[model samples]
Target: MDNIIKANQFIQEGKLEEAAKILNEAIQENPNDTVAYVNFGHLLSIIGEKERAIAFYQKAIEIDQTMATAYYGAGNTYYDQEMFEEAVGMFKEAIANGLVEADAYFMLGLCYYNLGNLPHALANLLTATEKNPTDIDAMFQYGLTLAQTEQVDEAISVLEKVIKLDENHADAYYNLGVAYAFKEDIEKALASFEQALKIQPGHLLAGNGKKQLEALL
Candidate 1:
């Protein structure tokens, strides 16, 4: 089997040191292999070697300017470091290079959300959900962005979808309660909050929401 494949199997089997050794040897044997470089970068990132991961991603980019995975890997590292602006640039580059994964769009949305660009964040998150309807995180973010933009009804609908996707999604239930409260549907809001707390005992937001609803009643 190929060294990259073997390394990937090792990684899946939780043998990080073996995987790292194989990847390192593969890089040394084929320095120009962009895929190997990107995979190695991802492994390094998982092990908390953020700087080294970015360096490997940069090396992959140097070898193949059109390597979208390399750009996306580097963007993820930047995001982890809280460098939202740099992450936005790299994610956009990945998109421009034809990386159409939901994760790329989701990360771009998160970057825009972090930068307080609500419209752009909504747009990207909406696209991410469109690309992968089953991605609960993307759906949750899309719902949250809608709520932030004051689209309360739409936010409720999206949050409901998230709840359907994962019944135990406490944050979705809490956000749904918030949306219902914004619409002055006090009874529904209280019920949603109760559901959230039921799923995640002692959820602070759910508890607060329930208290506020009770006071209103």
Candidate 2:
């Protein structure tokens, strides 16, 4: 089997040390292998060695300027370090290099969201959902973004879709309640909040929202 493939299997098995050994050997044997370098970078990032992971990813990029995975790996490492600007640059490069996948778009959206660039975040997150309609997490985040931007009706629709995707998502239910409240649909808001509490008994926000709406009635 290929050394990188073996290392990946070891990684999946939670044998980090073994994966490291195989990846190191693979790099030594074929120093120009961009895939091996990116995999090693990913493993190192998982181990919280962010700086070293960035170095390996940069090495991969150096070997192949068009290596999209290298840029994506570096983007994730930068994001882990809270370097949103660097992450944005790396993610954009990854996209430019043909990494037009939902995962990449989702990460880029998160980076923009963190950087307080709502418009960019919204655009990227919408693209992510278009790429993978079944991604509940992405859909959920997009709904929150819409709510934050005061697009209450649209937010409600998206949050409803999230609930359909995962009936037990307390956060989605809670946010749906918030959207309903914004539109003065008190009964529906109260019901959504109650459903959220039923799903997650300790949901403080939902509990508080239910109380506030009840007081109004």
TM-score of each: 0.97, 0.97
Q: Model 2: which ten-residue window has the lowest total lDDT?
A: 1-10
After superposition, candidate 1 runs with Cα above 4 Å error: none
User: Which residue ranges in model 2 land beyond 4 Å of their true spot?
Assistant: none
Q: Mind giving the per-residue lDDT tens digits that candidate 2 earns over 83-153?
A: 99999999999999999999999999999999999999999999999999999999999999999999889
Please state every model's RMSD to the true fold in angstroms. 1.1, 1.0
Global lDDT scores for all candidate models:
0.94, 0.95
